[model samples]
Target: MATVLGSVRAFFAQSAYSIDQENPGDVVARERLLDRAMGEARFRNSSEKLRRGRVPADGLALVARDPDGYVIGTVRLWNVEAGVDASGNAVPALLLGPLAVDPEHEGKGIGSALMRAAVTEAATRGHGAVLLVGDAPYYERFGFFADKAKHLVMPGPSERDRFLALELKQGWLGGAAGVLVPSGRRFGRAGLRKAA
Candidate 1:
């Protein structure tokens, strides 16, 4: 019975792929694939901005690997805080960006698999909402939207249409407003404090 069930599952697996949390040593291949994928995606500027931040130390990265152990896609999340609200409350939020897939592997469901793994891991880790500057149509499929606009601002100039947010948990935004900034201990003790 177990053998039969396993065979049945494999038959309907759709694609023979696996999504997992990226290990530290996978950085080199991940970067190569990311560079290739971003180049193909025509998001050179966005890729450059992400590279300058040293995202690995600040956020979690998940990758989709083929059976041969090659990374074909990747997604990342960073710790960031909202700018400031009228009442002076600093809203804390997560920054999601740099989602890329190997050009040759696009439309193979790798990007979607990476996103699902990242979001699940983030929710389990007790994160708030995730804010990003991306396409509305593509991101909306993952439950991301502009509902948090009043409580969100990007670090740099971003088109209003592209900026979006998604609640990882219920009411994660809580109507808070502020500019997004890096939230990491290395930034200094003063910066380590969470915003109200």
Candidate 2:
């Protein structure tokens, strides 16, 4: 009876250890995860559109990795500016999007972690705001909203509700309003620099 109880305790201890080893704190480590998560469909579609001499290379790319070192999610930002706002300020903003999480890991907080990291980085780099086209409910949790309606617009048609922005600093979008051009010159030298 004593031996059986000891063995049971050992089994339980090993199980706990295994679980701990499997769930290390989420971290962003590399760009490969973004490439892999983008996959062919994502690459051919959204990525291709953004990469077409438009998106800036200087923008940021981030990923969330699990304890096993597997990339579970990703987000990217691009250099952009908004038209003059009510205050007559030319608001330079960052376009945020293409946030994706592994299907198997969708509900595990990986997406949120990636978003938090990107937002923090953008703020640290002195960006005014981060914009995106996504669900209001999901993004709202991260302080994204439609407050830029008066001064923000996308180059192509986009649902008004889906268009959103988050200010990293107070009055970041003051006096800015206009079409959001892809960070590059639609593919010129500046564009090349952005895509680099």
Task: Give the candidate number with the greatest TM-score.
Answer: 1
lDDT of each: 0.64, 0.61
**Cα deviation in Å at residue 106, candidate 1?**
0.8
**Candidate 1: tens digits of C-alpha lDDT, residues 91-111:** 666677678888988887777
For model 2, residues 65-178, the per-residue Cα lDDT tens digits are 555555566666777756666766566777886887777666766677667767776676677788888889999999999876556777665778888888888877766787
TM per candidate comes to: 0.76, 0.67
Worst 10 residues of 1 by lDDT: 187-196
**What's the distance in Å from true for residue 17, model 1?**
1.8
Give the distance in Å from residue 2's predicted Cα in candidate 1 to where it truly belongs. 25
The residue-level lDDT of candidate 2 at 97 comes to 69
Task: Supply the TM-score for candidate 1.
Answer: 0.76
What C-alpha lDDT, on a 0 to 100 scale, does residue 99 get in candidate 1? 84
